[model samples]
Target: MKSNLLSLEMMNGQERLHEALEMRGFLVKKEGPFLMLASGSSKRDLRSLKMLLNKLHIPIFWNGDRFQLLTNKFPVMMMKKITEHRGEEFPVSMEGYHFRWRAFVNRKNGLKVDALDLDPHIACFVKAVNEAGIPCLAGCDGHLKHAPNLQFSGVYSGAWFQIIQEQYLSEFELNYTWNVEFKGGSGSRLVASKARNERWDRHKIYEDTLKMAYKLKEHADEIKKRKASSFKRNAGMKEEAEGLRTDGRFEELVDWMERLSN
Candidate 1:
């Protein structure tokens, strides 16, 4: 194993992470949620692959139009000095991405159970980027091969507004932590323990979240319509039961219910 590159054994949720490597014909091993990939000559290839995943560009339907964001659906950008990345006011620039606002939460560290500040700063950052007519992209730290880091960030950012629909208007909770239990692995904890005391304006974060929701209201309504239609189709399965209850044959109805249960 190259000391410069990350070890796959240290990665959390490798079973799911295996899919990405498998797609490229890399042999992998799974022990619970952790994974191990063959190293040596393939190591450089692995790192390069992850780099590509970190900057994936994909399209999403937003407000009746298609929008492209960086690196697949979720952009996973990691910060070296996350707290400093935010400005005294609005729009903190971390690396090259400008965050209009940031939020922090106190949560138990997935690695050692120590409390840490879980910052989903990217959540509101992406929202602001999209609102400003900029192509939003999720970013990664370019280190570990964890699933939530590699995969869920992409998936979460893709449906961020929908996942936190009602709560979008509420106080920004820094409580978002990706937790998946493993037999011997720490839950792919992303936060460092030193930054638990970072301060943020909850109200301002809430306002940015609301802005994100308002911008995507049309898309949310469309999603609701599709869900309702799906429920209506599934409700058809109860049509026979409703008919039986309406008819006067009580014993026959009981028999039909028994048959359906079986």
Candidate 2:
């Protein structure tokens, strides 16, 4: 019988990654719960992703743009041995235990991304791909305890190519088609909200801090009354008041209060 081993040929990093995912039975065509669903994601999570991927925004109108909008439907499964086939090396620990799991979402729209819903097994391998920013590793087992990328230790860097090519040559279908005129605002609103927040953050030092100080003072006064009643201070109240007194910018405010006290 012929051995089933993945071979590395002439494919770039991204292409390799796509292929490796296929070999492990995670191509877009494979219909499982791990596919992207249009209705599953919440408005809040979408808004956050839109803000985070703001600079990385690609439009359906853009010629090379892949995913304009997408929502992960289900989590991917993780297992030590997906099948009983041989001739391939599966990830194993020194104790001969397999490191496997359902760690994350396998489906992405134009491009694959990671947030919270990833399966732990899928998350380990997928996170490595995202962090490497390329199709450098195919799959990961346990928390790698190696050097700089110890967490990614014992990762199958070549498996990426194996699966990606397999998916492309095999039958894979895109979940949905993006419209050239598709401008319904999955993320644009979030970007605008973020811009407003940046403006708020810019002036927050003087205005926001003063507002916080006012709130703290109200609590501080209650503490003073408590202290008068019982010759001891509330630790929480003392800490808050002292924070305003000793901190750099607050020091100036504290000095102003001392002059008023005098």
Per-residue alpha-carbon lDDT of candidate 1 for residues 1-262, written as tens digits (9 for 90 to 100) = 1111344344333222343333222333444434444321133434533443344422222222111222222211221222113211222122311111110001101011000111232333333323322222332221222222211121111222223333333433432332212111111112211124543444334334334424443244443333233222234434543454345333454454334323
Worst 10 residues of 1 by lDDT: 107-116
TM-score of each: 0.18, 0.17
For candidate 2, the lDDT comes to: 0.25
Q: Pick the candidate with the highest lDDT.
A: 1
Q: How many clashes in each candidate?
A: 14, 23
lDDT of each: 0.28, 0.25
Stretches off by above 4 angstroms in model 2 are 1-37, 42-44, 60-114, 117-121, 124-142, 146-262
> How many angstroms is residue 185 displaced in model 1 relative to the true structure, after the best TM-score fit?
30
